[model samples]
Target: MKGLGPQIPTKAPPKQSPHFRLYARKYAKSNAWTLKVKNPEHSHDSIENIMVHPAFRKFNEQETSQTAQMSESLLMPRKIWAQLCSQRESDRPVILQYIYNQIKKVKKDKVQGRRPIDALIDTFKEENFVWSSERDA
Candidate 1:
């Protein structure tokens, strides 16, 4: 039972970017089912684990009950999976390209920690996004 360093207040994530809302409306007829209960084909099991990485598990460590912690674990992974799935119905190819570029910067700078973006890029690749070297025209 010990307190960690100076506790920083956490902020709720902002609403989805305006672009996602507009994009969703355009694709709603086709992509709306992703908002349902089933796991979309794109979410690889290993990649989803990144959301619960040890670096982040502490955020849920103080949950008052096991149910709260369980829901916390399930909700974040599902939300991220659904967002990426729906994103694919639009310009996902371009988004994956953008994510690949960010990954390069992280590697070039020798970033010490495993960042959230790194996990995202890895998941995208696992979901079949080809890297530039292997990309086809």
Candidate 2:
């Protein structure tokens, strides 16, 4: 009567979109959060892709504290990285550069805008370490 088969428009429809949108909300009464996914399909598989992401390589709180303690103890970043890798058997190994950066960050925080020598002197004073310097005639 009208048409024998489906109709194809003169203009092509829009291409398949790859965007994935996820929304999260927390209710005032509940301690849990709810996640709403607009597009459940993911662009890539997480299992194979997660290890390559930089965010996945970040240290957790415990690792950060351990790194700080090790750095304060004068352990080299490479050794610290090795120790961290040995402690964790994750798919992504702890990077040496990350260890170096973390140690640098810890040291910077410890210095707190003051010079390193000043911080060291403060630490020595706190620990009651005595040092006397003789004036040259």
Candidate 3:
């Protein structure tokens, strides 16, 4: 015989949990569901937080491998190129001035159609050189 009351079922799980009543009471209205809506789109974390796209990463790897395969000595650094350019710029005016002076020094009519070597020979007179005299002949 049980106690004074009628016998109830043995221990079994009821449908609801202890917290369900409090949760249901807090969110009772149908409009409550609309207030607590969920976003469908979710974002995941990247490997190291440096989100480089796969295509760019592949291209970079290919470029690095190709460069490695070639002779590394041929690759000029930025500082060297900059120095070369600056040197050229500095010397350009001096070279141009020298060329200008040389052009001005040249006689126009005397050497107009003649080659440079021929014109230079013509500059000296024939009297400058004397033939050896045979007894002052």
**CA lDDT, every model vs. true structure:** 0.42, 0.83, 0.39
Candidate 3 per-residue C-alpha lDDT over 22-122 given as tens digits, one digit per residue, 9 for 90 to 100: 11224566545323324433344345623344432221333333333321334433433343335442222222332233333333444788876666555
Q: Could you say which candidate leads in lDDT?
A: 2
lDDT (10s digit) by residue, model 2, range 13-58: 8747666899999988877899999977876556766777889888
Error of 2 at 62 (Å): 1.3
Q: Please provide TM-scores, in order, for all candidate models, with all chains considered together.
A: 0.17, 0.56, 0.17
Best candidate, TM-score:
2
Off by over 4 Å in 3: 1-110, 130-137
The runs of at least 3 residues in candidate 1 whose Cα sits more than 4 Å from the true structure, single-residue gaps closed, are 1-73, 76-112, 129-137
- TM-score for candidate 2, please give it: 0.56
Question: How many clashes show up per model?
Answer: 0, 0, 0
Candidate 2 achieves a global lDDT of 0.83
